[model samples]
Target chain A: MRPTPDPFTEALLARADDALVLGHRLSEWCGHAPTPEEDLALANLALDQIGLARALYAEVGAGSGRTEDELAYFRTDRDFRNCLLVEQPNGDFAHTIVRQFLYTAYADPFWRAAVGSADPALAAIAAKAELESAYHLRHASEWLIRLGDGTAESHARAQAALDALWPCTAELFEPEPKARLPDPVPLRAAWSATVDRVLARATLARPADGWAQTGGRRGRHTEAFGKMLAEMQSLARAHPGAVW
Target chain B: MSDDRRARAWAAAAAVVDPELPALTIADLGMLRDVTLAGDTIEVTITPSYTACPAMVVIGWEIEAALARAGLGPVRISTVLAPPWTSAWLSPEGRAKLAAAGIAPPPTAPADPGLFAVAAPACPRCASLATERISAFGATACKSLHRCLACREPFEAFKAHGDGSISNTASRDVLS
Candidate 1:
């Protein structure tokens, strides 16, 4: 049986998993994005997310005799703690933009607060991540606005994407009972304000918060997560000790 | 003796040029944080310009190689993230080198603008302030693509990487 992780480890893992999963999803658009500029932008964003995940995983792996690779590659779907929003597939450009915008809105403020964390290592990581998160938020917000206020077709697609992805965002603010880190609950107000301002400009309506999806924090994930994990872990599993 | 060794190690590490931006040394970019001789081991600390800067691995290896060549072995390289890196940390020399290499340097003034705030980067080719951003991202994470209206030349700008304040006291302390 696997040893139960402490609250700090669990919380840290959740953050890492969210970054890795979303990074991978963004990477899927590397060559497929609508424009050359967008292709490069998506890839750059993916790199930033993956970098954040690596740092967080390194922190989690400290003293555990497990490297970041071991932790990321060896973990199964049920053991992953990312929110449902990240593991969702890249349906279209509209879907990808909407997903990123929602996540970044939460992440920017979250990192800003985390910069003051009592944990020095975490604070350090948060300091670096905060700048990157700000860039991601700005990039996504612009795209969202353009899509929302563009032609009728683009507006419809952007709205549809936002509606589809809205439910998963609630899980991002769920309180971590055992964690001593910054509470995400308090960040919701700022997130809402940012979202509201962006949506107002985008001409997009905020979906009513109804049935919220949970369980990612508890290691339960959606179906798409399994397939994503399989692909992500395949190379490491294939070559147990491969080095570049 | 240890202080002398530490100085040598610091110089060796600082002299290492960034593989991506060869025109500037790591010191000019404000990436070399600290160097100390802990007993026989030399410890070096650095901060990446961006979280996922691809140049970091190369830079680390280059530091090791440079120190090794200088007989400053047993080096331990550590990365720090606090106070995060900003383009404001780029030395005046580094900015000049970047402009010479046909890339626009980031503005030195600290102005926190909104997401869609228009950045009017002066063109490196003709020194024209009438440049338009082609894209928010460029070939690397630390740059943005821009085109000059006067020169009709495309250039990359080392993006301003900060919240709203360009004057990073931590970086100033290090750079000074």
Candidate 2:
């Protein structure tokens, strides 16, 4: 029988999956971004996210003797624990930016509080992630404001993106029972403040909160996630232990 | 004999230059955190400047190779992330080397410019304060792209991370 993961491991895996999936999504835009500068920016964001994921996975694997690659490539979608928000496809530039803004808004505060975690290894990862997440938040927020406040078409797109992505965000704050790290529910206030301020500046209306999508934390994911995972894991699975 | 071995190991590791920023050694960039001799193994600890720095893998291999060439075998390299690396850790010599290489080194102690404040890094080419950031990110995760109004030249600036300071000014032109 598979042993049930402790709260800390569960929480850590959820965080890692969130970063890895999001990072992969961002990487899909590597050559496709509208501008050369933006291409570099998105790629850099992807790199940071992937890097954070790697570190978190390494931390989880430390005790289990599972390598980060094994943890990442070997896991099925049902075994993954990322929230629903990150698994959504990159709809458009606006959609991507809005999704990133929503996640980074929560992540920056989450990492900051996590810096004080009693677990030293987790704390170290948090410290590094906190710095990177701050930049990620800034980049996403800036693009979001520009898109939301720009010409009529851009503004409409931004608003649409916000409306679509907003519901998925509720899942990010669901309480992790017996979690040793800082509870994400408390971070919602700060995330809301950031979202509200940026939305106001961007002249976008806050989408009213309604029915929220859930279940990613328990290994349930959206339809798009399986396809993304299949692509990500294909190479690793095909070339098992293959090294250049 | 062990003391001599440890010193040799430290020297070898210290001499290794950052593969990305060739102007700076890992020592200069403060990437090398600690080196200790534990039994027959020499354990070296280092920190990454950014979580996703591509140079890290190369740096590890370089350190191992450097020690091996110095006759120090059984070396283990480990990375730490706590007390996260900041641009503030760049050594004075490293800063000079970076400046000499036409890249603006990060502000040693950045004044907490409130969020939305623009970064004004002096142009590495002309020492112009009249510089504006063009992009928040540059060739690497650790840099931002900037153009100097005085020299009309574009250059990369090492981003000042972890200081609660916003360095990217892509939305508004701060130069007026």
Candidate 3:
């Protein structure tokens, strides 16, 4: 029988879910991005996130007598623990950029802190992931600035995306109470600082902290998440135990 | 197996070229991690520079065949990700080879994360610092695309590996 995952394992699974879901969303833009360079950039970002996710999932399944594929594809929606911010729809290019920027801005420092995690394996993974997050943050930040300061249309779209996504931001800062890890509260300050810096440079204003939605960390996700899972898991579900 | 036989087997394994960059051998690329020989069993460990590097399979096949050709059979290839591979592992000789082949090596990890610190590598062709990054990612996961402003020549750079510049073999050796 598969052993029940501990809290730390759950935390890893949550982190992995965040990366995997967002990676899938970002990869959908491949061959469909605004430019060939942007296509590569987005795909590169997706690869980094997916790589991180794969590592984390591998760790999670190591002693559980389970495979990473089983966890990623066989699990139901209720078992997922990604933040709602990531699972949000990639509405438009502006929307995708905004979503990516917000997540990377939070993730960069979070991974940096995780490098010191008491769990050495997690620490090693974070050490590798943090650099990728840094690059992702930079790419997203550059696009935010260009779009926000470009034209009236671009500016409006950037702001609109920001407003739409802001409600999901607070959930990222919420602490995982049961996880044996550093307090996330301190990381919140750094996240805001980075976000403000990018927004200021982009000439965009921070959306007023309003009714902050939550629940992705505990498995409750938005409606769009189900469709995403259906599509992402379809092939794996169709071919059980099949090797690529 | 004798110690001399094991040493020869390792040397033969190291001679395998990276499938992506033909100029540099696996040892020069720092992909060859460890080789253990017990009797006729040879266990070889490698670390991939990129998580999804397609060249890993090809490199594995090459290593196995090379070891076999060296009269070292029953070879096994495994990968380790804990101490992830980094581009800084590219030996000084490897860097020169890359430059001679018109591929730029990535800059060191920047101290501060304020700006995109992928400073333009001096163009291998014209030896110019005046270069622009045409794309943040290149054909492979471990490279980025750059174009030399001076020579109007485009090239790929072996990107710095892992987070914050930690590599499998780079922490110990400094490339001049």
Candidate numbers sorted by lDDT from highest down: 1, 2, 3
Candidate 1 CAPRI assessment class = acceptable
lDDT of each residue in B28-133, candidate 1, tens digit only: 9999999977778899999888877788888999999999999878999988876678788899999999999998998886454576786878999999999998
Report lDDT (CA) for all predictions: 0.86, 0.86, 0.82
- Native A-B interface contacts kept, per candidate: 0.72, 0.68, 0.33
The better-scoring model by TM-score among 2 and 3 is: 2
* Cα TM-score of candidate 3: 0.90
Per-residue lDDT, model 2, residue B154, is: 94
Q: Candidate 2: where is the Cα deviation over 4 Å?
A: B112-115, B163-176
Question: What is candidate 2's lDDT per residue for B1-176, written digit by digit as tens?
Answer: 99999889999999999888888899998889899999999999998999888888899999999999998979999988766787878889989998998899888776434345678899999999999988888887778899999999999998787653322211211111
Q: How do the residues B52-161 of candidate 3 rate in per-residue lDDT, one tens digit apiece?
A: 56688899999989988887779988877657677767778888888888888766553333454455778888889999889878877877899999999998887765
Q: In model 1, what is the error at residue A217, expressed in angstroms?
A: 1.2
For A101-172, candidate 3 gives per-residue lDDT tens digits of 999888887877777778888887876776667677888888898899889999999999999999999998
State, as a TM-score between 0 and 1, how close model 2 is to the true structure. 0.94
TM-score for each of the candidates: 0.94, 0.94, 0.90
User: Where does candidate 3 stray beyond 4 Å?
Assistant: A177-180, B38-40, B108-113, B116-118, B162-176
lDDT of 1 by residue, A205-235 (tens): 9999999988898889999999999999999
Worst 10 residues of 1 chain B by lDDT: B167-176
